[model samples]
Target: MVVALVGNPNTGKSTLFNALCGARARTGNFPGVTVEKKVGRLKLPTLGPSRSGGGGAAEVIDLPGTYSLSPRSADEMVSVDVLLGDAYGTPRPDAVVCVVDASNLHRNLYLVSQVLELGLPVVVALNMGDVARARGTTIDAGVLSEKLGVPVIPTEAHRRRGLEELKTAIVAAASGPALQPVRSLPDAVVAEANALEGWLSEHGCPDVPAYLRERMVLDVGGQVVERYRTRCTGDLPAHLGEVRSRLAEAGCRVPAVEAAGRYAWAREVLDGAVETTPEPAATGSDRLDRILTHRVWGLLAFAALMFAVFQAIFSWAGPFMDAIGEGQGWLSGLVQSAMPPGAFRSLIIDGVIAGVGGVLVFLPQIVILFLAIAILEDCGYMARAAFLMDRLMSRLGLSGKSFVPLMSSFACAVPGVMATRVIENRRDRMVTILVAPLMSCSARLPVYLLLIGAFVPATAYLGGWVTLQGLVLFAMTSLGAVVAIPVAWLLRKTWFKGETPPFVMELPPYRWPSPRNVALRVYDRGKAFVTRAGTLIFAASVLIWAAGYFPGDHTELHAVQAKMENPQVAADMSAEAWDALEERRRKLSADLIADSALGRTGRFIEPAVKPLGWDWKIGVGALASFPAREVIIATLGTIYSLGGDVDETDDGLRDAMRRSEWPDGDPVYTLPVALSVMVFFALCAQCAATLMVIKRETNSWRWPIFTFVYMTGLAYVAALLTYQIGSRLF
Candidate 1:
């Protein structure tokens, strides 16, 4: 049997799903996160053996969280299609489990009533019953069940209460006959729906349900009709208009009439079933919202929160990163000791270990960033943050809904682009998707930390509360974020010119962040990061190792090493003589890299990157990082590792870079050059995965191509300006 889980946004539906499915569930984007679906096997203890001689596990699908089945946007339409079995690759669920928030029973029941009309066996799971009881709200579940003509099981999904009963209810409902809706639409509306259903059947649009036809006629401008006409032939639009006109004359106007009638029915259901007890002057959410949702205070709070988050990301992850670096060094030493001295040994120690390890060390910071985001989202502050940002976002032709996706980009742009599905307007969604990569994702963190540590002094500034380096890092990310504003505005004024939709969102009452959910999110994000490292970054690392390792002789380097290791010469020579020999060996290694395939490629692009204060070495790193931005750290590590014959430690790379010089013997990587490189990476679309996601989201290669071109141009100009001005001033 197949069961569908549906609910309003912020209801404890997901928690319930997780409780039932545990680690058995799998999450995937049907199209994107806003409409992502999760499917899992729900095993029932009471069911024992199946009647069909199969296991007793039922297939449970968690559909996207939606307010109603009304087709307003594509995302919401997905929910309706899946419920109605109209979506391709999804069959009609054997039963429907409608989870509703008990505290907000009247409004929650509005969606339940709509599901009831779907002619499916639905068992309403009254979630947050504990929260409701605590807030002096009492819900008579038995009364509600009787009134709605379905099973109602009060459940506290977080506490795992009533889950067994809920599961039993679902199994029983699935085994029994499907329940029909008790409430009926007005006669005129039903007549119009019947007529449209007949018309749809005649027009070769067979299997169109009555509820769907009613929705098509009601939501004339919605995705339902837009998707339907593409299937049926002849004058569908004209016929729809005539049906709508007839309905309006019968006192039914598109969305307004549908909404009013459904809400009226919901209120009638809740009138006797729910009761409230008077208590405190204000609920905790109300008091907190005063400060959290304030125009002035909320904005300040958001900035302070982000500042703290960034600071923690930099400072808190330091020790773990250092430990990781040391571990990599230890592992590399073992590998070097085990293998013969040749290109193969170098591949394992330098190419595989150094390159992959460079990206792995930053995993701590990535985990912390995701943890913070998860906390904010769980505790409900994220919604308030979006609300506060909506005013500013509006001026840039974006809705508050766009704020979540843009903010999500700070962690990574792939998920950030997917998050844009929440934005209802196509123009706003596209613009947000294009500019999201500018938010300085965690992939850029490795580069920022490497460059900042190398050049910027870690002194305190602004009365000593903030370190100058931290402030600079914050400022660099802030600059990247600021670039999105103008870019979005320009794009809207030109290609995507349209009215920005008004922002509307529910602010779920703040609750303690669930440890399980936060842990799961952090784990999922960390897994994704590691998976990319092992796959994409790993392949790139090997390719780069091959390019830098082969087509060159190591005979001169081995000769210098042998001479330095000779006991007769070492015992007879002074310490300075030994040091000179080692330096010569290092020079030989550097010379070898300079003549390698990678070096030649870097030199080939030198002229193009020179204006940004970069030489061929930096050019090589930049080019290697085009596949993945964070790979630049590993690439630079590889470059400097070969240059100084040192392991890829932050200190080692920094010292090597400090001692590097141009052909004229002038210092190559000055403060201005470091800052220029940082600015360029911050603004550039360096991650191919992000570009691919944009293509997928927009369903066009054109937008992704345009994104790459514009962002690259912006990065180049920004870096050039920063370099020229800073070089002259400092």
Candidate 2:
């Protein structure tokens, strides 16, 4: 049996789904719409008093939360089509579980009423029962069930309360009476629906249900019609026009009629079933929102919160990150000590270990970022953040809905692009997708940390309250968000020109975040990061190691090692001679790298990147990073591993980079070069995963290709300007 879990946004539908299915759920996409589909197995109880283990697991699908079945967006339309069994790859659900917020019965019932109109047996899951009771609200489930002709189960999903009851209700509904439409349309509206059904059949439209026929005439230019438009035959627009004209002539307006009728029936159904005391003058959420949502104070609070988060990522994660680096170094030493000196040992230590470690060492920051975001989202401040950003987004011709996805890009761009399904306007969604990657992702964190630590002085600002390194790191991340604004404007004005959709969002009440939810979310994010590190970054690292390692000449390397190990020469040599010998070794290492294929390729691209103040070595690292921004660290690790003969734990790469000099004896990597590199990485579209997701979301390679070209061009220009100006100033 198949069942769908449906509800309005913020109704705790997801929480209920998780409670029901736990870890049995899997995620995919709906047939035609790109919206995510979550399905899980719900093992059903037996029918009678025994309620034994006789039944099989029911497949429960969690549809995207939507306000109504009128279908404003593609995602919302998905709920309608799936319920009607019109969506491919999904049959009509055996029963529908309509989860609603118990505290907001009147408003929530509006959607429940629409679900009832679909002619499917619905078991109402009155979620947030605890919150409702806390607010002095009482819901008579039996009364609600009698009034609505379905089971109403009061559920506290977070506590796993009423789940068994909810399951039982689902089983009862599936086996009970056949359902009928709850809200009947007016005679005139009914007549129009009947006439339109005939016209639709003649035009080769599918045999839509009576309620769906009513929605067809109601929601003008909605996703439902757009979804099936390909199969529609013989002047669909004319048939729709005639039906709408007759309805309007009979005094039933198109969109308003549907809303008015649904809401009227909802209010009637909710009348005596829900009883609420007068709200207090100042609720806890209201008191907090007064400051958090204030125009001036909210902005300050948001900035402070972001600053604290970035600071924590830098300061708190330092020890853990260092330990990872040291651990990798120790493992490399153990392998080096045990194995005979050969190419395989070198590959294991230098290629695999160094490359993978470079990526893994940044796991602390990624975990911290995911934890913070999960906290914000779970505690309900994320919605307020969007509400705060909406004001600024409107001026740029982007919807407020775009802010959430854009902010999500900071963790990873794949989900950020996926989050664009919430955006109702096609133009707004595409524009948001185009610019979201400009927000610095966790992948770029390693680059920022490496460069900022190497170049920026670790001095305290504001009398030790702020560290300069942390501030620079924060600035680099913020720069991405800043640069995205103008790029988004340009894209809005040209490629995706359209009127911005009005932003409507609900700021859910603040509550202590559930630790379980937060942990699960962080775990999922960490797993995804580790998976990419093992696959893409690992492959790139090995490839880079090969390019930097051979034509297999270790003559110069052995000579340098022999000289360094000679105690007799060390005793005879003065300090200056010792320094000179070290310099010679460094120069020989550089020369060896230049002889390798990777170095040759870097030299070929050197002139092109010279304007940005990059040497051939930095050019190679930058080019290798194209597959993933995180791969730059691995690439650099592999480069320094093969070239400098240094261990991973020695902080050797940064030191080598600092000591690097041109043939003219000028420094290769200065503060200006570091800053320019950071700027470029901040804006570049480097992650192949992000590009792949963009292509999938857009359903075309054109947008991803365009994204790469424009972002790379923009990054080059920005880096060039930064380097030129910084060179002059510094």
Candidate 3:
């Protein structure tokens, strides 16, 4: 049986899902970690075979956190359709768990009431009840259960409290009845809901009542009206008939009026069950909202927070990163000493460790980045970040939800693209998808750091506290995001013209994030990263190694071996110069890579790209980074006198790039080229793997093709502009 865990974005639904399933959880960060859907399996330790339902092995899918049933965005609509059993390939949930932030019951119940209309069995886990009581809010759990006609369990999922009780509730709902009795709205409200159903008849069989009562009320909770309409190919005929009837009766679509009634009915049901005493007429959220939502300070705080994230990536990961480097270096030496000098030894040292280790070295940065993101996200500041940008976003005709996804694009476009699922309007989702790739992703990190660390002087810019290099990094990312804003605005006025979805979202109360919860997240995301290192990364490394390996016989250091095997060279060199000879061997090893197939391919692309000012080496670097962008550094280092440098990854490449040259007596890769490269990456569709995944998620080649073509075109134009303009000025 499929048990769906549905709740508002931060209501601890994921934590609870983890608790129930333990390690059985499957994580994809799908559509790229932004529209992450976690599906986990659970087996009851001991179940009465005769009595257990669905054969006792259960799979629970933790859908994207959605606040309501309205299909406002693609992902949000996924929740609605899944609950309605209308989302293609998704089974109707045998039972659903509606997780609510008990402390924020008033708003939480707003979703709860919506779910009740779905006519399905549900159990409400009054999550964060511990926080609720601590905040002097008393929740009458038994009363709420009786009023809503469902099981209620108080849980602190992060602390693992009340989990058993929650499971019991879930099982009871599953085994007792296939469908639970729905809480009927007041006669007038029900009549109005029916009237909505009548009005929506032109919309189809899965009418407004089914969506309102099933997913919104009984399953997911919260009345989120998604503006993007979805009707299956098979259902379009019904929709056509429905739309015909609706147009036949004009002035009948009353989304505003129906919304008021839903809220009114919700208020009545929750009136006395949950009590919140006013706090001397001022709340902490309110007080903080004053400054945090202020037009000026809010922006400054955002700036400061963003600075911290980048600071952690470049600065905080240094010592540990260095340590990791030294350890990998030592390991390589040991392997070389132990293994006989042959292709096997080189494969282990250069191909496997160098390539794999190159990618692994960046794990620390990923961890640091996601940790900071989680902290800001959990602390509720992220919502405020969205709030602060509301005015600016509205001018661009965007919902506030569009902001974080765009921000996340800096780390990776895949996640950023997926995150746009939170936006309910198809046009908004589409436009956001189109612009997300423009943000400088984490793949651009290695390239940016390589250049910025070398060329930009590390002296204080405004003061000694801020290095010019750090400021430069921040400015590049900020500029990338800034460029996307005008692009989004332009798209709205042009090809994406339709009503942008209305932005109506509840801001949950701010609480100190649970460390236990944060710990779980750190571990979960870390585990996911490790798995990638082993799987996709492992495969990509092998493929790249093969590309660099073939077309040469006796691949045992072809350049180094040729010299050593030469009798004249052997006679000239004495035992005293063996160490020098070995160093020469390393340089020779590096030279062979330049002549290899991978190297030749770089030369092939260089001519085409040279007008954009990149050399053959840059072409090789770009080629190696298809799987992931950070691998470019390793590839570049390997191409320039650092044999097997992809494995023996080093920061020296940045310095190397500084001293490298072109044939014309000019610097091959100067500061402007570096900046242009950064801009190109910020706008370009560089990650082939991300493009492939986008194809899988959208289930069409069309969107991915559009994404790749438009983004690459934009990247080229932007790079051309920057270079042509910057060259004249500088």
Q: Is candidate 1 or candidate 2 better by TM-score?
A: 1
lDDT (tens digit, per residue) of candidate 3 on 59-133: 788877776666545566667666777655567777788999987776667667666656667889899887677
Local accuracy of candidate 1 as per-residue lDDT tens digits, 184-239: 46767778878787678788798888887777877767777887888887678899
Please, what's the RMSD in Å of model 3? 6.3
Clashes of each: 0, 0, 24
TM-score of 2: 0.81
Model 3 TM-score (2 dp): 0.75
Kindly provide the TM-score of model 1 when superposed on the true structure, using C-alpha atoms: 0.83
Better of 1 and 3 by TM-score: 1
Error in Å for residue 198 of model 1: 5.1
Candidate 2 Cα deviation (angstroms), residue 370:
3.7
lDDT score at residue 717, model 2, on the 0-100 scale: 97
Encode model 2's per-residue lDDT on 1-730: one tens digit a residue. 7889999887788778888887777765676555767788898886843222234568899998888888867777788889988789998888899999887888888888888878888899999887787778888999999999999999988788999999988888886666877764567777777777777777787587887777777878876566556677877766778878877887888878877877788888878988888874456888899999999999899878867776676677778988997999899978866765556777998789976785676567668767887788778897788788888889989866787677767766765776676575667888899999998887798788888878888899899999988888999989989988888888888877766777877777787777776776666556655663345556656776788767657676656656666678889889998887877766655666667777789989899999999988788878767656766665565555433433323377788778878889999898899999999999988876677667666756788899999999999999999999999999
